[model samples]
Target: MNPEAWVALALSLKVAAWATAINLLLGTAMGFALARWRFPGRELLDALLTLPMVLPPTVLGYYLLVLLGKRGWLGGWLHEQLGITLIFSWQGAVVAASVVAFPLVLKSARAAFENVDPQLERAARVLGLSEAAVFMRVSLPMAWRGILAGVLLAFARALGEFGATLMVAGSIPGQTQTLSIAVYEAVQAGQDASANTLVLITSLSCIAVLLSARWLAPQRSAA
Candidate 1:
């Protein structure tokens, strides 16, 4: 592979890592809440969160552009107040990957949390463990493997994020250009060799991640 391809790979890894970290924190909390807390619109919230998984990438990109564009409401405030710009930047790529990959972690984490025995949590509470303590000591530990599987999947998804990242971050070589974007660029420019290299690398990376996730995921007993 060429140096440019290597750089794109590194950048994609960086974006995926950042996205996975964000998803780990946010997805875990939301998953635990949805699994344990009953409230009005709970299902509604889950549906909304899961929408990205099924939505067209271009559509999601449009939404992100609208919400984070220079003249957008939140974007305008952020740019004015914090002097932060997300458009056509690598950070924007991170945000795009995070949004696109979040649902995998959320769904996996929710299922993991749900699989934990509520009775164990009750016992922990009965033992005078605070809610926080119970979660930290019992719930989180029990669900970690499943959550990890989801995290791996999210990382893989983020690594390959294309349309949204391109829309929000554009394809700036060695800046905002990720592996997937590089592939697109290579193909567009008729650089078949570079495109093949990128495609191979991406496929291998995703395959490795999926295998790792499968290995780490909890196995079910025969019914």
Candidate 2:
């Protein structure tokens, strides 16, 4: 691969890593809450969270663009007050990837958390462990492997994100261009070699992530 391809690959990894790192904690919390707690509008929240799973990537991207574009209220306030512009930037790509990938990790974590015995938590509480202590020492350790598998899956999903990324990040080569975007542009420009190179790398990366997930959580493996 050339320097540009290498850059795209690097950026893709960076974006995926950032997205996964953030969502790991956030998604785990969301999953735990959804799985263990019942409150008003819980089902509504679940449906909203799962929207990305069923919605078209472009549709999600469009929503994000509208929500984060300069003219949008949140986006306008962010830019005006905080000077953080999301549209057409790498940050925008990360945001897009994170949103698209969130469902995977969230659903996986929810299932993992559900599989844990509630009695274990009660036992920890009875031992005088604070909620935080129990979570860190008991709950987290027991559920970590399953959670890790979900994170890997989310990373892989983020790595391959295209439509939403393009809508928000606008595929600027060596800047916001990720492997998936690079492949799209290469094919569009009839650069078969470039496209093939990116495809090969992406395929290998996805396979590696999936294998790692299986290794970490073999019991959760589908196949």
Global Cα lDDT for candidate 2: 0.90
- For residues 18-109, what per-residue lDDT tens digits would candidate 2 score against the true structure? 99988898899999899889999998998899798789999999999999999999899999999999999999999999999998888888
Best by TM-score: 1
lDDT of each: 0.94, 0.90
Q: In model 1, which residue pairs have backbone atoms overlapping below 3 Å?
A: none
lDDT for each residue of candidate 1 in 161-201, tens digit (9 for 90 to 100): 99999999999999999999999999999999999999999
Q: Which ten residues in a row have the lowest lDDT in candidate 2?
A: 214-223
RMSD of candidates 1 onward, in order = 2.9, 2.9
Report the lDDT of model 2 for residue 216.
60
- Model 2 residue 137 CA deviation (Å) reads 1.7
